[model samples]
Target: MKKIFILSALAFSLAAVAQNQKQAMTKPKTTPNKAVVYQVFTRLFGNQNTTNKPWGTIEENGVGKFNDFTDLALKEIKDLGVTHIWYTGVPHHALVRDYTKFGISNDDPEVVKGRAGSPYAVKDYYNVNPDLAVDPAKRLEEFEALIARTHKAGLKVLIDIVPNHIARKYEGKTNPAGVRDFGADDDTSVEYKRDNNFYYIPGIPFQVPTSDTYKPLNGEKNPLIDGQFSENPAKWTGNGSRLARPDINDWYETVKINYGVRPDGSKDFPQLPEGFAAKEVKAHFEFWKDKDVPNSWVKFRDIALYWIEKGVDGFRYDMAEMVPYEFWSYMNSAIKAKNPNAFLMAEVYNPKEYRNYIHLGKMDYLYDKVETYDKLKEVIQGKTMPDPISDIQNGLADIEHHMLHFLDNHDEQRLASPEFAGTPEKGKPLMVVSATISTSPTMIYFGQEVGEPGKEDAGFGTHSRTSIFDYIGVPHHQRWMNGGKFDGGQLSQSEKDLRDFYKRLLNFTVSSPAVPSKFVDLQKVNREHMSYDAGLYSFARWSDKQKMIVVANFSWLKDSFFELRIPAELIAQWKLRDGNYVLHENLYGRRHALLKVVGGQGTATISIKPSESFVFTLAD
Candidate 1:
């Protein structure tokens, strides 16, 4: 088995080299306004607690309110060159906290994940999470004001829409008039109904799993901390598990939201017609206009439209692959018809369905985690070669502009966590590769810039992913928050320096037209040139008027100087002949290099320190 794995890796490496060589010979197309998304966990962004109790409650560890995104905070994020702010955990979800006094529903502690809740297990689609507002009754108003403030700061807003599932106790209290709640008109007797919102297990009652390693609210005293949850007939788990009494690890708090897919894995609703992939949003909407689709499909579409009407510029769909593509086609088409430029991004892990989701579903972007991010993570961890970057780009060349790139999000661990890279500085090269390699959107989690290690064991979530399931404060991010000032007054020198580096890099990408220009990988052609290893990657990005070369060293232990030989193809593309060209490096100030083109090629002595990245502009 080991031998086979090694041989397969070797074959892939060879193929990647060939692919890069072929790609270098061709030219890349430039895009416009490459989006930079700043994703923040709304509940934790403004909290300032050092005592990270494992299973902390709302009173024990206070949560951040929607009002916390002050004008100064929004301006700072905008100044970082962020075009969109993904406000995570905004929608009301099932939680252990009681808000019954505010006319809100109380989630059963046995079913909820932690003191807070899993943001994916949305309890209500039309209302904001009460915990996020200064007053629980004014949650929706607070969120609307936040959206207006974000737009005022010259940034767009995005919130999550989990189309595949909803909380076990689903309700739509704040839903607009004439809207029917989920399961209100379902036929409970039949196991398979086209209009049913959830699949039922017939006569089984849902039982909470008993685990020695886990407890509701960490054994804290609560009146509703019972071991039983009421479901007349247990439904399937979020991951599609059919067990009535799901295991402790199953997503028991949520039930799958059916979209006309029957129990036998066949589509009950009309599948998208042939060649629908090449159609526009209007065409998609027209096709579904007269078709008889399931109720769940229309419900989700109305839910999305409600938010759009409430001033949300876009939506980030959770586990989008789990839902049928036909539903997305209908829903996204309606969304686009309402707002043509609304950014619709989804979490799709399968590479096979990339084109289908983007073209047929009318989605603007999809997560590039499977190909780009996973490969980059391996490179950052020193387990693989970085030469495959060009391979990834070429593999998804047709849809490259639609692949969203990121190093950290709510699902992923912090870049500086022990489980990932032990130092935040390791992210320098990775971030450069992520931001500059493709014309797709780039995203950074809120605390990622300041090196939040996410070491807090906040209730249901362990060390790694910052907890959305618990009411806990992020320590490193709190220092940057500095008691609601949103300044780095308490940050260390190193931390401040890291943040400054991020600021410069982020702002430069948003302002430079070169970022959206054609990209050329130079490392493949210069492998044998002066100590260049797999840890050092280089590329060139250029438009008709703006052009720049970037080199990033992923190695943390060694610094080396090398002669970066610009390929003849790139030299010809730039129309350089034999005269000397002056080049100025961004990180190294006024230090310039004289590149003399001979035989349609140019060379420069590039001195890159360990974990350093440089951007060189041609000064003519």
Candidate 2:
């Protein structure tokens, strides 16, 4: 009788424990820290040249190498709260420099853009850029070492994967055994083949564009500049131009890769079955296990896998929407199969295809340039009101976590440039809003924090965006480089202050647990109650244990104080005791305030400086 009673009591205890564990699992989980990406043009990060002459040769203007990212440099980046280092233009792209002595084939001058050539015009898939290596013969080895070092620094690596097109001259010299070069097995006789690598314009010869604004070698004479690139049957341009000679403004230096997409706007391969959007990466991989994709899809998949195997953590697919989503379904699934936590982001612009790419294609993130960055730019430029930010957040509420926000990138103008906000200080408010707006990742160009205006007139590249096709120097960023000491010895006081602000903002976002939690927009409520103007925007981010009120004053010249009102509904939802509470400021630690709540309504008087932002955290 005693044994039976003991067994029954133990069974009851086990059942109660199981019930408690099940309830715990059903509760909502707290979100972790958001990702902060630091994008650096590998060829420009370490260059200390001030000579930014138009079309300057590498001998005249210096070029940065992979070895430049020493341990100290990476540690400095990590200290800035960066989680990933996006090394742009790391592959072996088309360049004017001759590497013939290294057994590499020469690229035609007529078909190449700029003196250094466009980074998007890739030459070899399995090799690194010779210009980015101290010794051209050991470029690949050096790149592998860089990848290893990046991993050792506790930072993930992201490199570009331009799948929509490739350089006019595509060769796989360093490919592994049994790996064939693109177009090697392709049939050039047919214009449209499901298996063909490129679209052909039969019976037509490739011609260089006749533009008065551009010269093959910037009017510099060269033996290779014959004004003719021999292609019996010309291929379509990278921008989908089917002309034998593409327009100068088009992507004339690159040829589009055909991934079973016919010229008639029809697909040659099988499309995803219905309801595939509801599946996971594993299911997607299984669905395509016995399937046959196009040869181009396989080639790109192999390319991505090659980098992933080389210790590359992720890929930023260039113009991802230009390629079919089906190919992404196959390629990204294969990548996930290899590394489930791979960071797969893409440059997808179409809002219509956003969910399809994220859900069905298994992309981890996409460029938020159109909805988030563009709206933020409008507010900064005084072209639009700040009210749209709330709408943008609501519109993308479902996939806000998958949109990556940024103020500057290679394709956009620098914040300090005259073409942009005309000063880096204007970016302070913008950075705060962009970073804390959603659960999305935030990125910044290498020199953006130090105010690299990119005013240098690089050949074949103009103002606004940084030049990815020339040997030019970034003036402001060089000061921070400090002659490769990886210190800010030469930075001005104001520049140092700005960098400090960026460090604080990024580090806080990456370390704060409340950032990825619930977000409540205070714009509408503050606009009505506090008499806040269109130049001011406010929002609240909170978790069970922490809360923050973010306010950004976009006014270029106005400084004012306003009563920040917390709505009664939110107060009730938070279940806070109506009493006096102290709030601590995150930016400037000296700013603290007392919050007064009466009958479920809370209000705090806060002062904001002109073109400044305040991140206030609730303190117990």
Cand. 1 Cα-lDDT:
0.83
Q: Write candidate 1's Cα lDDT for 195-270 as tens digits.
A: 9988888888888878998888888877777777888788888888888888889888898988989889999989
Please give each candidate's TM-score.
0.93, 0.94
Model 1 CA RMSD to the hidden true structure, in angstroms: 7.8
Question: Which stretches of model 2 miss by more than 4 angstroms?
Answer: 1-32
Q: What is the lDDT of residue 74 in candidate 2?
A: 98
